[model samples]
Target: MSRELFYNSQSAYEKIHLQNALIFELSKVTIPSIREIMVGQLNFINKELAQKVAAKVGVQVTELEFPNQSLPADSNYQDLQSEEREAHTKLSAALSMDNTIKNTIKGRKIGFIIANGVNALHVQDLKTKLEGEDAVVEIIGPSMAQVTTNDGSMVTPKHSLTSIASVAFDALYIAAGEDSVKELLMANNKPHVLNFINEAYKHCKAIYFGEGSEPLYMNSNISLKKHIDPAIVSWEDETPDNKFIDAIAQHRVWYLELERNTQD
Candidate 1:
């Protein structure tokens, strides 16, 4: 179980729900005469809660201690006892995140919302920076047709505004250009574009509004909020690209979900 499931639970109701879920899953184990189970990293915050759930299922919980000594250099894996193999497997699972966690933004999917006459410089500059960090960037336009940038450069969109929802990407960037913003605000596409921004805002995902994109921002549900949201980067921010990248790396601002969704 993730420690966040316990420590980050907002209320008693959520805690109870988690406990019930744990009990249901535990009770489904069909092994007969199961008396005790060893759970690693069963520390202070989650240990007591876990024990209560286990007790409801009639099982005793024990802390799984890591082996202190290293195995012999010539030891054969096939000769190890089943119990030893199980212990090693559990240890690996417990420490997996330690090896997997890294300080990089690799593989994050960022969506750039644009229309014909989009700001070529803003689109290219941010895309270059994000791609340099190994993040996957996709251009989402009003349609799949080639979008003409302010510089008259043609850019192909990977997705249309109506085709993909905000949930499909890790973060969103509203590309800048007076004409592009105007095109996005047209009667036919305004609703879809606003829905994209509002949904991404509601979900606490990072959203960067480039220069000349204020009209869309003011028209979206984001304008309704009075609170300062770090994930919602605007052109007024200094170094907006860096701020957007940092926000994306942090994933979602889950702590502010309530405020973001509240009807003001």
Candidate 2:
């Protein structure tokens, strides 16, 4: 029973570690006051971790603001367990937007996936912008060093699709044209599509989508919404639908639950 309980307790922390949330454990009957006290105590035990995350994500436990709210005596406590787990997860993953925004942008690699007859201007425009931010952008396509643009420019692709695995990128921007997108939808290539998102999601890396790139995320495990707008970081989506990039870059949504997760 003790061994089983130990693992059960661990599940909470593991969930947060994997997802990147922060929380302190409490006895089932512990008060919200105690939980807040625990958070305060963690400040002493791990001040750097506390101050760093507090700088961006805000270390205050926003959800426990209500008075006299404690887990019910009859409560199964699954909620408590889930909550603690998520807290640890987010704290581990917090990198401040403020700090990240200030860092040197050198050596950041952005991979653009495209094919023959693609829009050369889109690729160039994005590459130029990213380079302005000090990121190095590379093109991955059919054969080495060149793909035809839709508007008729001869463009060079730096890495072949076979060689440019998704993990090779810090962030991925996919702009597969109609033909490429459709072919990626093929039954045989479905695994390729799934594998791409799986690898990116597993790594918790950032992905930016061009039009028609939704299908790549259509069949991945784990809820896309869970990762879409990560609770731990701030993402400024240039496009209306792609804001999740910030949280994904922060990597791991967190093992803890937020108030949103505990909704009835």
| TM-score of each model, paired residue for residue | 0.64, 0.49
Q: Which lDDT values do the candidates have, in the order given?
A: 0.77, 0.51
Number of colliding residue pairs in model 2: 22
The digit string of per-residue lDDT tens for model 1 on 25-133 reads: 7678766244234222233236766576767777656554432223476776445523422221212323322233435778999999999888899899999999999
- Most accurate candidate by lDDT: 1
Alpha carbon lDDT at 23, candidate 2 = 30
Summarize candidate 2's per-residue lDDT along 1-264 as a digit string, tens digits.
221232234334343342234432233324655545444444433444344333434345333332223568876555554222223232322233222342344566767767666656666766776687667888876557566777877777788755657788776666635555555556755565556656765555556656655555455542445433342212133542224333333434333233224435
> What are the runs in model 1 whose C-alpha is more than 4 Å off?
1-102, 258-264
The reply for model 2, stretches above 4 Å from the true place, is: 1-104, 142-145, 186-190, 220-227, 230-264
Best by TM-score: 1
